[model samples]
Structures are given as C-alpha cells and as structure tokens.
Target: MKKIMFNDKFSLTQAVLEGRKTMTRRIVTYPLKFRGVNVAGYFVCKRPSGEVTEICMYDEDERMIDGGQILPKYKVGEVVAIAQSYKDLGYDPDSLDRDPKDLGIRGFMKHSAGWNNKMFVSAAACKKHIRITGVKCERLQDISEAECLKEGIEEHLKGIQYGFPSNIGYIGQYPFSNPREAFSALIDKVSGKGMFASNPYVFVYEFKLID
Candidate 1:
C-alpha cells in the first residue's frame, strides 16, 4: 500500500467535491492536546497514483474552527475538479452519512461491525514493541455501545503502562467532552509518549457502535 503524504496547500472540501477519495496519510502539525473536547485536525490522503490530498475538518464542514490554517504553498483550487470526480464516483469518506464516531477513531470500524481494536507504538517497534492495549471482542454479536466502551477500558487497563488505570477506570466511564478527545488521549497513552513523535505511529482499532 502507498503511504499518504501531507499537502499543506490543498482544500479538503474542494477535493471531496471533485470526487477524489481521501488518502490515508494523517498528521498533527500542532501540539494537540486531547482535553476531551471537540477538537479537529487535517490529514493527507495518498491516492493510488501517488497524488496527495490534504483533507481536514474543512472538507467536512467547510471551515476551520480550531485555529488551523491552510498551507500557503499549495493552491486550494488547483485540484478541485479532479477531487470532484472522485466524489461523483462516491469515493469520499464524508459522503458515507455515518456519524464520525461510527467511523471509529482510526477508521477501523469498517473492518468489523461487531468489534474494533488498535495498537500504537514506534514504527521501529512495529514488529516487536507494538502493543494491542485495547480489544473489544468479548461479545461480537450483541454488543451495546456501553459494553464496547467497557471492553476497551478493560483492555487498556490490562496492557497499557500508564494513565489508563489512573485517569480512566472503566470503559465509557471518562467524562470526555467528545469521543475524539477521549480517543486521542487513549492513543497518546498507549504510544507511551507524545503522539507526534517522528518515529512513532499509533495503531488504532475500532468496532461498530451498536445502535
């Protein structure tokens, strides 16, 4: 699979409208803190052909509320039409109509409707140091949203080294302002360091949220 790279100058909304599927390259350009609030960031998606699209909260909402700004190097309108073509073909993630939470914190919910799981570690440790801190596979067939959270918390407590047992005692028990913040904090804790380290990539796993 091709890796996604960030294009500081692109407009995610225009790319989606042009019909280009967003690539999977994601980054955090700023010092983002998961304060259990509704925070957002930009991500870069790499097309199969190696072209990069910088998709962000702007693509889904048409505005940036988190003090983020578009990169000045790339032209926002240059790839609008090409991106629109991708959208016309139904390749956009935003068009799926599911709540962002339903997509899972790291887009892992798409693989298993019953349970979602992910692990994060240094890229160098991907094979050896990578750890699966959370798992939600206890009851795949009839899981409630509350139960899913409980399983995640249990897994975190079992595998993670810090923060999990101290801050979050049980799944779905934290008073996060939003799911994103809670998920972000979990990623940080599991990674055993800050989230934007040059050599680390947090593995994200997610399961379908039962209605």
Candidate 2:
C-alpha cells in the first residue's frame, strides 16, 4: 500500500471527498530507455496495430521484475490515504489548521507556509482512503470524453442536475465547453503551458473511495 497527496487548489481532493472522482492521471517522469537502450533501460512495447503499450518485463528465470507493473503507485486491493485536512478528522471545518508538532505529520515545509509548519497532513490524519482498481498508460491527448468524466471534471462545472435551479451553469475556471476540454485545461494548469498538447505518457489510475 502507498499514500498519495493532492493539492487543494485543483479540487481533485475535494472531488474524492465528495465521492465524485474515481480516476486520476499522472505523467511518467522517468525515461523508459535502458542500457544500450533509449530512455531508462526499458524496452518499448507496442501493439501490432502500432499503438504503444506497456510490457511485462521478466528475467531469465521467467520471474518478473516490478511484478510487470508501472505507475499507479499502488496495486489492486491496496489501500491508499489522501493527504488533505478534513473535518471528520477532528479539525475545525472553518479553520482546518494543523499543528506542526503532530508526530504523524512527516511533510517538510517547502514554499507553502511557515518554514517550520507541515505543508500537508500526515497519512494517519487523513480522513479519506481509496483502493486502486486498475492502472494503465496512454497519451495525454487521447483521453476520451468518457474518461474525462471519469476524472470528475464535471464536478467542477455547474449544471441543472447539480441542484442549480437557475438553468445557468458555471464553467469559470477553464471555461471549456466539454469535460475533455476542461480536463485538458486542468492538466495544462497543473503541469505547465502546452503540456496536454505535447501528449506526454501518462499513468491512469482507476480507484474507488473506501473511507
């Protein structure tokens, strides 16, 4: 099992808290080439149709290294903790301030707040948990509308079904007309300019809230 952190601004942690988000994607940072190889000693595997895909790597004994897994950081049925402050954890909903001395918190203060304060909550103090259901890799631009919806992009937009009686829906942040576009905007905002358009390799995690 592993613990994953989320920033407060993107509302991803919020979406998980609300049980609206069931999936997320993270860019692969390390190059895949290996010795005498291209990126990080990894062999590139592709489907017969020319579509790039992941491979199941094994040694001479037929035993797999990394157990033939990449990204997602967690395996199926493994529990993960969310790194956000929550009211359910005895923190005041209005203030939600954390004390830096709590032994459970292991975060180092980077640029977020006071130099001695914890930048994020500890895994033990996290009020939400999730279980990984599946994992995959894909090009950033290939995400479909359904997949974007699965990322909970719609949760950030206002709509009639969301209890806004006015018929007017808000699409303020990214101002995109669809979930896929909104998702693209979100990736750009978080990663950097032109990131989504660059079509980097990304790890997609399918999960369900367990806490």
- Per-candidate TM vs. native? 0.19, 0.64
- Which ten contiguous residues of candidate 2 have the minimum total lDDT? 109-118
Give per-residue CA lDDT, model 1, range 7-112, as digits (tens): 2123322332232213211222433433444445533322121222222233234444334432222221222111112222233343333223332344432332
Winning model by TM-score: 2
| lDDT, candidates in the order shown | 0.28, 0.61
lDDT of 2 by residue, 1-211 (tens): 3467654577777778788778888876653443444432443332222222354444444544444444445566678887654433445433424445444333532322322222345566566789888776777887888888777676343455546554433241454556777787888887888999999777778889987
What is candidate 2's CA lDDT for residue 132? 83
